[model samples]
Target: MADDSNTEYLLDASLSDADAMAYVPDPVEVPYPDLEYVSTPETADTYDKYFYFHREDVSFEEALADIRDCDSLARGLNSGMGYQDVYSPYGGLAGAAGGVIGNAIAAAIFGSAEKRRIRRVNLRRCMNFKGYERYGLEKDLWQRFNFEEGFSGEAEHIRQGAIIQQAKVASGPKPATEELGR
Candidate 1:
């Protein structure tokens, strides 16, 4: 009989392992936004001023999602379920990781949802503006509706729906022979 260990070794060598393993020499650093790192009163005031002045360019839904992301990170950091890297010079690697995850989550929501849900939420919020209900004009809707809840839930729903739709399409029937001109 053939040696079992030798046969196993041969099988392992023949099988392609590219998909099962990766040899990343260095871990890529994740880019994260940190509002706490905004040093000085001037920097803080700048964001606030921008928020007030550029309300037209920015939507309430986007702001709400950002807030939720930050809030989630803060909660995670405070809960102590995170770890800190030994080589972090700033002693804030844990918070940085949290921020990275939060930002990634926020970005993923927008990308996966096709931005449909966020647009819808913003539109709904704009339509519900009571202050300018009489005029029916397009204006800064945030002045009337406070997006405390953010559009995170709606965005998530849209993302999930898109994923399901994508899967359904992928698993759908093959094109007709006539349609394929086969």
Candidate 2:
């Protein structure tokens, strides 16, 4: 129905470490825990649902380019850019191994066409594929290529944990926002 293979948004530091820093917002005064620090491969899987469908016609390099765009969008969001601001071609990097090596590993993971077909169907029902476009993809590649979706339910569970922790931080305690003299 749609390509899902082009879904995952992996982060690679192409920008000099300095430039990458610019994509992060300044620390908030309230001393909140860093969401970025808590981001694990599992958390990424929450968004990884986008790649559930894939197209075989598209080359591996093209697929990786698509994923890179997804990564860029993710960074922009983390930097405080609105969803509309980050909207454009190629949101972040794609492919396995951070988009540097492209999809060799992914193909290996999807060895059989039958397995891929099953994965795609499961992915659509389980993950939040809507975010994938901002991450890149009109439709997931797995649909086109019949590739199996790679994301696991574990990602959603872990994200829920992080959300709970963030909520606790927000509601637990506070320091005065105003300067001492003011």
Candidate 3:
């Protein structure tokens, strides 16, 4: 049989192997994988900071699937398990009042700041569970090539997907530090 010992490890990668799969080579002082090492120049004078994940052996398809699954899980958890049956309340005079109530209720349930925060936390947990480690970057730099949650509209979706796809083999997300100007 073909040697799948390594491939099997990838399918159910455990946190125990995290250190063995370092994304960044240790300054070339020691032997390392032939993975590409990326160094980005400063674009903006300042940046809002956030963390992203990196695993040396992950394929683009795996990363994209993991991100999508996490996004769905986070949103579903934040929105709750209620079956919100929408009945049009704009039918008559009394219905107008019901419409207003429906709007208020919807607003209260969806897209609140708290809900967004909870979603982010859940996303982080799910990604971590998949053996991804967090690395920090300036917000401006990250948005250039990542799939962030809470972004809407078709154009934005296409742009994000394209950039991420283009960088399918992108590796080595360095932590934002004092020198990087985060």
Q: Estimate each model's TM-score.
A: 0.16, 0.19, 0.43
The weakest ten consecutive residues by lDDT in model 3 span: 3-12
Write the number of the candidate with greater TM-score, choosing between 2 and 3.
3
Candidate 1: residue 49 lDDT (0-100): 15
- Residue-wise lDDT of candidate 1 within 47-127, one digit each (tens)? 321121112233333433333333233221121223333343455878677666766665555543444334333433342
Identify the leading candidate in terms of TM-score: 3
lDDT of 3: 0.45
* Model 3: per-residue Cα lDDT over 46-127, one tens digit each: 2223445665677665665666567557753444423344466466666666766776676566645455566667867887
Please give the lDDT score at residue 149 for candidate 3.
38
The local distance difference test score of model 1 is 0.27
- Backbone clashes in candidate 1 total 0
Off by over 4 Å in 3: 1-49, 76-111, 146-156, 159-182
lDDT order, best first, reads 3, 2, 1
Report how far residue 176 has shifted in candidate 3, in Å: 8.5
Off by over 4 Å in 2: 1-53, 78-182
